[model samples]
Target: MAVFLTLVLGSLAARATLADTWPAAIACGLALMFTLTGIAHFVPGMRRDMIAIVPPPLPAPALLVTVTGVLELMGAVGVVYPPTRADAAGCLFVLMLAMFPANIYAARMPDPPASMTANLGLRSAEEAVYLAAAIVVAVRGGQ
Candidate 1:
């Protein structure tokens, strides 16, 4: 969720502000994406899957998982406003970093689920791309 949000937000922020720089489209896409995934947080089956990914170091895994979904909702809303885009992207970037361990832990699980990002390499690439995109969005959004 964080990676996808940051990637879309950053991609928009990287472009020029003078024209229709595609930020609006990307942001909208991200908003939609997060909305679906956020909803998934509440689904019992999905929640179980999420529980499997929670890192032990985190004190409140369940709460942390729930809060992340809420944050994604907030990020989706924040990315829609031009004045808030940069800050939203920056925050999303940090969120991605924070949640990365979950990806790592999940990858290490035996018979890790059959998701496209179930492996360490794929998850790492996903985070890397998202981080770059977030940087671009933050840098170009204000221009």
Candidate 2:
């Protein structure tokens, strides 16, 4: 199932024109990001990086990181599930929206990371990707 979904979406990403390509790129990006992050959950440096990216008000950074990792994994899995791709896309959309504040916070804070500005732009691009994926899912009657 995973292989088939990846192939179909991957092909779409590679061959589709701009209109069709955006959503496929978004889906591929979301899938790859989730799969990688899911693996990174167990890495010490990545765990810390995740913590830093999340906002200050959030307590127990480790726990939040774990939860986020789990959600990403689930969403990635759902994206490959023919019965649940849309639901997964919706979940990802909400997750992206929920995390936007943290990205903005990181971008605007004084003494932010050297990459913070770029990270913010990347995060916005990611959000746009999700929105594009959502539109694709809707148009195709995903799930």
Candidate 3:
């Protein structure tokens, strides 16, 4: 997901533009993506899967999970505004880093669901991609 996001945004950014609309589009896409994912997290069976990904010691951290989801949703919404998109992307990057522990935990845990391993590897790569995208957006967004 992150990798895909990065690729899409990077491709868009490579072009010359007279307006900031490209960055705006990138921000809007990211915001929508995160907002939708956050919504999915609250669906009935989804919570358990999320808990499983977190460290065992934090298994029941419902509040923390909810807060993170809200933040993700908010960040996405915030990114759509031209005045806030760059900062919002930066915020999203920090959020991405903050939530990475859960992914690492899931990857290292013994025998996660059959699909978990593949998902973890994919997400790890995705994170790298998103990081690069965020950097690009941050550096070139205001131009």
Predicted structure with the largest TM-score when compared to the true one: 1
- Candidate 3 residue-wise lDDT, 1-143, digit = tens: 54375446544653344234565556555665676667756865666666667776764567767888888878766766667777878888898898888888878777764434436778788778667666655555545
Candidate lDDT (C-alpha), each: 0.70, 0.64, 0.67
User: Candidates sorted by lDDT, descending order?
Assistant: 1, 3, 2
Model 1: ten consecutive residues of lowest lDDT? 10-19
- How do these models rank on TM-score, best leading? 1, 3, 2
Model 2 misplaced regions, further than 4 Å? 1-29, 113-122, 138-143
Tens digits of per-residue lDDT for model 1, 1-143: 45465446554554344236665555554555556667777777777778768878778778887999899778877766888987887887788788888888888887665542676887797678666656666677545
Provide TM-scores for the models: 0.78, 0.70, 0.76
Q: Where is model 1 more than 4 Å wrong at Cα?
A: 1-19, 114-116
Those runs of model 3 whose alpha carbons end farther than 4 Å from true positions after fitting are 1-21, 57-60, 114-120
Clashing pairs in 3: 3-126, 31-76
Tens-digit lDDT string for candidate 2 (9-99): 6636644643244444455545655676576765777676667767888888789878877987888787656577667777877876786
